[model samples]
Target: MSAANKGKSREKPMASLCAGAIAGGFESFATYPLESLKTRLQFGALEGGKPLTPLQALRETLNQGGTRALYAGCTAVVIGNAVKAGVRFTTYDQFKSLLKDDEGKLTAPRSMLAGLGAGMMEAIIAVTPSETIKTKMIDDSKRAQPRFHGMSDAVRTIVREEGISGVYRGLGPVILRQGANSAVRFSSYSTLKQLAQGSVVPGSQLPGWMTFGIGATAGVITVYSTMPFDVVKTRMQSLKARQEYRNSLHCAYRIFTEEGVLRFWKGTVPRLGRLILSGGIIFTVYEKTYPLFDSIF
Candidate 1:
């Protein structure tokens, strides 16, 4: 094939990553208030330190942090998710291509496996540091004595005080949570979209509104499936110079034993809301932009 034809053939691989990056950045910024709330509830006192109700959390976030504070680590999130979405979309597509059968048939299980790989890749490359900064900012704001003035200050302080490891404190749980999350989210969304389109292949596109609704449904599924891991991840990451659990497994065991099995579901309300909206926005943007990028590339 000629250069033009070759570029055309590779359109998806070439542009999918870039398209995803753009969409991911915008989605994260657009939906950050929910994320801040999610993170706050995830670490706040379940029984102490003033009730952490959803409305109360929202009020506090706005009052204490201001509108700007609502988007505490927006830069980290946008940049991180740009990389995360880019890597995940590109990697997942590659994996799915490889997993397709001789007749170009891709099964749901294979799609899930690809999503697993893509999630893990993005977790390692992006989620760890992004989460570190984000969690820190929110956790700090809750205190009368805030830690850092801004993202740059937070970065410098964290690095100076705790070294780089501070940024990766809860990596284990992050990996597990994200890996499972992406797998379930992508597989379910794809399956739902396929069913709606009445096909096993990727051609028939759903209406934009339908896609958003389905994405919200998928997000609900993801939130419930991963809430336990998310709670543990937050606890592990949010320890404030006071050592909490020893590690991820310890964190899980402690939360289960000390707080009861039900305790692991902390932050469910905000998390559910955030993810529901997030899933709809992110996937809707991705699906709509994907073809545009493919054609342009």
Candidate 2:
């Protein structure tokens, strides 16, 4: 390859990785309170009780342990999401490259397929264990006698009590949720960006506002499409998984039969709030940062 082409090749993967890492970590940290709320709502849903509104849940969490309660599992998510997003974008780029046409263009279907693979890859490598730990920590914090003092304590306790399987409690639903999530978000974002730019050209530049808007739209679409899987994933990863849920399907069944279909979307408001912000933040950060990384690296 020409020296310029070789340089571009090297830049692509590294830029994608670094940009995605920063984007994911920043987004997760900024929106962690919403995530904490979502988990608590999902956990509450497992009890098949009257659903708490987002404001009520927020108030209850704050009252229970003050502002710190809202960030009970932030550390795990920020770290895990960083790694997961790094893997996600790098893998998505690789898949996109492979799936592109002879003209080096990617269609929507191919983009979705690439995202699907990327999502599944990230889920197995990072999201599953991270989410399990985060959920357990949040659950423990709700107890009369909380066990884990922090991230390390949570990890040690979970490992001692349940082994590796404990940290991977929701692998199946996580993979499904993430795969569908990426597929919808990435494909829609790509399609929306193209529409906004009025072109299908690769590396087409868009204004920051446009990128954020498109990303947020894509996130909303993703949240609605894959919500049930997300709820099921959270329940399966909870500390009481063995006692409350036989498996992902059983969890879904119970949620549907006992709590009704809407119960599967118990955490929608807070989760939607998070995703809206996360979509805007992650895509905006990644797009802006990638070029800088590309030039520097």
Candidate 3:
């Protein structure tokens, strides 16, 4: 491609990133309640056992903490997701462009590799504080008298109690889960989209809804397949002031041995549901908004 063409291609990824970030932020806001419930379910109460059904948990959280509680750590959620989505989308596009030049065509496996790289890179930077605050927010909602008041307090307390390292407690599992999750997600979405594009009648394209459906299926599969890692990630990060887990692997083993293997998949239902909803919103907004931005720019 000529320099002008290369510049245009570069601009596309940045536009995709901005569009993906906006979509991710909006989706996170819309699904905060489900996310809050999913986190509580995963981390469990300060005690143990399933104290609340998903609906009961939602009601209790709302009654006790009000609407604001649903949105706890939303700042971190948006920022983290924005960074994750932006990077993932932008990097995926860049990688695809590189692959096209190298191989003369795009393929599903190549997209998977791109997604894996992007996901791992973003997960390391984005998962730590985002998840730390999320756990704290969920923990706070369960208490009569909350521990940390809000996002700032949670950050302050984590740093004070456990230092900066504490905030990144579950970095290991996060990378494992999210990296695989992103790989499966984008790769599957792209592969499916490519298939759909070909299947459409001449002079007609696959609709945005079709793209969303494909993306949501990929998101659910990715989320559920890696959910055990997520359970471990949540537990490791949500430890109380004095509480500690030996490590991610140790935590997984303990949960398997003590709690049973089923414990590893705890909160899978709500998580799958959350991912579907969030994924739908994300892809829909991203696909729709990118065209608008492209036209504007």
Candidate 4:
């Protein structure tokens, strides 16, 4: 372990939580436009229109409401992701600490297990409600008679009309998707870091560029592996979810039977664009920021 890892091992979870919040907030702000485009692409078939390319969607969104349209639900996502990342990193670190062996080695499987638990916790505590609101808000933005004026307004309207469960619309798939996402990302990132550094030592730091590359590679792997879950989660959280599908399983089934299997990856391009940068930005920021936190306390 490097001094960084040593500090991390000794530090409390609050350090990683704060560091992760900073990382997640930055990542969300930087990649939100791509996220907006992705959600639109996911709903393309349901929109009853010709499918639009990313550029066309960007043009249309810009025409509709200028750059502001490109960030339709950015505030919700930024705040949600910040809290989600904080929870995820804090729990992941705690889990990892507990899972390490007598030699203090964290095998790939153990790392993946830790990540899985962290993701599930974050999804339930932070991701599902925020995503439900963000999805509905973005959907609202597409309507001529948009109901939501802002994030708080969206939350209020949803709660008023549908009750508290409205904000947890996609809880099932969100947990599944997030669990798989973290498992793959953290494990692959750890393995790649180890391979790059030629060591299996936990928290072995790498150069900035290498860390970014490894994180992006992990993101690509995670995207392809979990896209179907993501599509289902998005559909379940959409404002029309009540009418379109009964539940997460039914939503997935409808997507498969009505749209074809490939529809599960409908937003691949834009999501890929965002996640590639997201993985890099998140890990690099987390790794760099974590050390500062570690040193402080």
Best candidate (score: TM-score): 4
TM-score of each: 0.90, 0.94, 0.89, 0.95
Model 1: CA > 4 A from native: 1-11, 199-204, 239-242
Residue 276 in candidate 3, Cα distance off native in Å: 0.9
| lDDT per residue (tens digit) for residues 1-297 in model 1 | 001111113326767697778778888887788888878777655325754787888887888868877777778888888888888888877777677676665578987898899889898899988888878776776676787788889889888988999988789888998899989998888777767766334444667788889889989999999888888878877745237777788878877787778777777887788788888888888877887777787
- lDDT for 282 (candidate 3): 83
C-alpha RMSD of each candidate structure in angstroms:
3.8, 3.2, 3.4, 2.2
Q: Against the unseen true structure, what C-alpha lDDT does each candidate score?
A: 0.77, 0.86, 0.74, 0.87
Candidate 4: TM-score? 0.95
| Count of clashing pairs, candidate 4 | 0
Candidate 2: where is the Cα deviation over 4 Å? 1-11, 199-204
* Candidate with the greatest lDDT versus the true structure: 4
TM-score of 3: 0.89
Report the C-alpha lDDT of model 3 over 84-135, residue by residue, as the tens digit: 7777777766776776544355577877787788778777777667887777
Reference-based lDDT, residue 161, model 3: 79
Minimum summed lDDT over a 10-residue window in model 4 is located at: 1-10
Task: Report the C-alpha displacement of residue 150, candidate 1, in angstroms.
Answer: 1.7
For candidate 3, list the clashing residue pairs, or say none. none
Quick one: ranking by TM-score, best first? 4, 2, 1, 3
Q: Would you list the clashing residue pairs of candidate 1?
A: none
